[model samples]
Target: MKTLTIRRPDDWHLHLRDGAVLEGVIADTSRHFARAIIMPNLVPPVVTAQDAVAYRDRILTALPQGDRFQPLMTLYLTEGTDPDDVAAAKESGLITAVKLYPAGATTNSHGGVRDIDKAMPVLERMAEIGLPLCVHGEVTTPEVDIFDREAVFIETVLDPLRNRLPELKVTMEHVTTKDGVDYIMGSSGNLAGTITTHHLIINRNAILVGGIRPHYYCLPVAKRENHRLALRAAAASGDKRFFLGTDSAPHVDPLKECGCGCAGIYTSPNTMSCLAHVFEEENALDKLEAFTSLNGPAWYGMAPNEETMTLVRQEQPVSYPSKRDTGAGAITVFDPMFPLHWQVVE
Candidate 1:
């Protein structure tokens, strides 16, 4: 068995939902990551600098004792968002970026920007202050098929946005298609993207392979095997433009298993282990550290974490925890299908 050690990794994107669910899930993230860009799409949404501060405090309060995990916050971009508020949040150092979710694109994104045109002033303000705009890149037209949303969004939305605001830094969050991979690659140094664990490990077939595996279902849903191959190549390419972000969103079991299932995968507890499996299988284990630790901070203009962690290539069966206990109740956990073989050494 081989042993590898590298700088402590940060999850550039994650969802640590509020209160009980947060309490139950924070430890899983803290155990594996030193910091995470916390999504602000709560029930009411964190739209202002003040809201972001309060939300950050709630995330801190929810973490287990002695955990040094830092929750990097983001402001939810809405049609009526004030430019001054965006600047104020960035100046306060509480927010690292602004999240743009096309209205109706994903979970709790109904408050997201309905028309990107309406938010030009906000995006401009962010560009001025060096705040990157993290986008949930998917078109929500009723006529567009689910799997085609990402590619369509790039052509119809992102490309136009880039042409319009050439100075603005954009991160195409959880990119799932070959077109997405090409867009980021074609953009070179300016625009970047975050790849998720589930997207790298599973394809759309995982959803129906064994009779509708609800846990494998996620928004910006997984695509065909060829797309998965493209993602694998990009992540393993050691390209600084690509980096790690678990998008470890947790939903209650009942909500996920219901008729209209929720969209997210809860992999915070096992993200690193899973990535190690994928990278190792690709024979790119040597480049894992750059993708998992270095690329993200470089893209964000922050330094890599000073601390280090180790993982050993040992075969081990990891049980899937169906639910994480919190003050309220157990919040359901997503199943990553197979047992993980790598173990992180603290």
Candidate 2:
């Protein structure tokens, strides 16, 4: 098993922020992932089809020359979203799904849907049109403990929504709990989940144990060891319900190192290598293609990539840069806190 080749993978979830940050990180993702569900949680948010198209165009403009990558755009689902506009976006083939971020859930989510009821017309339309809703599955109430948000979201939000709209397709993005895994597994065909590379590797300990390692911190804040094990098991299980979504969020070093740090891990540069090591460790390398390449496209009703990527296991450790320079500022790369030996050779 010195070398592993699979269909080029797609990131079911990703965040390529606009402007200088977008320019700095787009290539890192395009180098390995063939396509990604581009997140819509920018400053103003891409809340309409026209916004998604413009954002997609900007992404293309920023894409490194000679890199073949597709940006799968999504619209932010605000309370006032126009169903006709949404349906038209889908028909026009410029948008792939709609995103719902509970207001104040994460970065730039202030415009997110506050009342699920208010957004139902849009959700119902999505269900009718067979469009998937990508939800940031966390409750933003002040009383809930940070670690409990994902579980609470499942019990209080997602379950009820699914029961209410059985026909709507949904992806619980960057799921971080055993409860989430169980919920998705116990569900019918309309539901699926994407596991992040960092989530599968780190837990609360990584963020709080030694010191406050801000870089290791992320939304749906990584849970306890048991939850991390659950995520790893789900990903390596070869189940179609689970797939890769790096959630490779990038923030400048200043923002992350300051008093109030942002939540995200910049892992696009090393995700495939880390995943290769993880799958190999689980002795489930045979199923890596399913988790990384095959399952996401299947969920989205698309053909798997014709292009292929080969990862070779070098005897020596692979060295990835600790930080990437965005010119605007430096963005720290995710340190898995373990040596990686696998490299994407082609």
State the lDDT of candidate 1 residue by residue for 169-193, as single tens digits.
9998999999999999988456999
TM-score, cand. 2: 0.99
lDDT per residue (tens digit) for residues 8-113 in model 2: 9999899999999999989999999899999999988999898998899999999999999999999999999999999999999989999999999998999998
Global lDDT of each model?
0.89, 0.94
Residue ranges of candidate 2 with Cα displaced over 4 Å = none
Question: Candidate 2, residue 282: CA error in Å?
Answer: 0.8
Deviation in angstroms for 310 in model 2?
0.2
For every model shown, what is its TM-score relative to the native structure? 0.97, 0.99
